[model samples]
Target: MPLTVNEIARLLKVRGVSQYGREPVSQLEHALQCAHLAEQAGASTALTVAALLHDLGHLLAAERDNRADDDLSCDDLHQYIALPFLRGLLPDAVLEPIRLHVDAKRYLCHAEAGYWDNLSPASKRSLELQGGVFTAFEADQFLQLSFSNDALKLRRWDDLAKVPGLRTPPLAWYTDQLAQVALPDNQAVYQRLRMLLC
Candidate 1:
């Protein structure tokens, strides 16, 4: 299931931007911002990559029309769809952090005391879908998962990436970055299923 360079290129080419929201940023914009912020915070390349692609589920979710708020908000469609597609395409060390990024957000909201109030409506809604507030046991479960620290860092960066007028890096940058990342062949099939956010 590992992604091929061609597959990654196509996926990146599909435009992860969205038309939803008053601010209206593309998915790729959000991801790149998160990656940049994570790098500024000294996150590992793997963690930065996780931040970059964590919302990949949205592409699949949009295609199925399973997106909350008409592709604006919370849902686990990406987790259900994108994760499986990425299984062999990305290393477990890489993919596991992406899988658990949302959980890291949830955990932070509940454990950090004041973090919950800062969550976006989409995040809150998705939290409900993800089973409301995560229990201590759930937090522990995520903590034990691979790349927990990186995921946490990326999750924080993901949230911070949303400032208005923050000039977004072009998709071409990500496309170039993907060239440096190894991917498997046969990734093109997955591209057909993603929602074109651009």
Candidate 2:
């Protein structure tokens, strides 16, 4: 079933407390920071929401000991994991970027000089697991996608969002934005139809 905006928020509230895979900040903190950055940069509502929920796949995947010391071997493929759950709930503007953000990272490393040096240790490690840097052909192919530029912007924000003590608005602050971008509530429509028929 597609998750409601509120249901997504609730899941973030609960599961987002986990440490972001070897990052200093919690998952919620990273998300809020990314959204804050996107908003500060005058991103559209869908882009901002995409920034906020980009890592949601990590949360929806099975609970993990994501602590800095837990050397887990699995690569989770988190970028694609949440799409099935979120497909109908959000617009392509939002969902497409979330799906491509990981690849954006890979693309940037190869396209931009010295980009690889800036990645956090965990990000660098994951880069290898995510198939290393994109080759020239791969980068060109990635650029052809509709939302690839937005995905690149989101990837930049994702990289910068890991500051340990950064302050940003709470998750509740984005509730209205989430609602604005969410799909119409089918259950509510169904109930209204039932009442009309009755």
Choose the strongest candidate by TM-score: 2
Off by over 4 Å in 1: 20-23, 64-69, 72-74, 183-198
Each candidate's number of clashing pairs is 14, 0
Task: Give, for candidate 2, the lowest lDDT window spanning 10 residues.
Answer: 63-72
The lDDT values for all models are 0.65, 0.87
Error of 1 at 20 (Å): 6.0
Candidate with top lDDT is 2
Question: How high a TM-score does candidate 2 get?
Answer: 0.90
* lDDT of each residue in 1-198, candidate 1, tens digit only: 345555645654564556323335666667778877876777665566666777776665665564432443445445446677567556665677777777788789768987889887766766777766778998888788767877787778877777655775665665455544534343455454443532
List model 2 lDDT by residue over 1-198, tens digit each. Answer: 567777789978888887888889988899999999999999999999999999988887755444332234666788998898788778899999999999999999999998999898899988998899999999999999999999999999999999998989989888679878877775356446756988
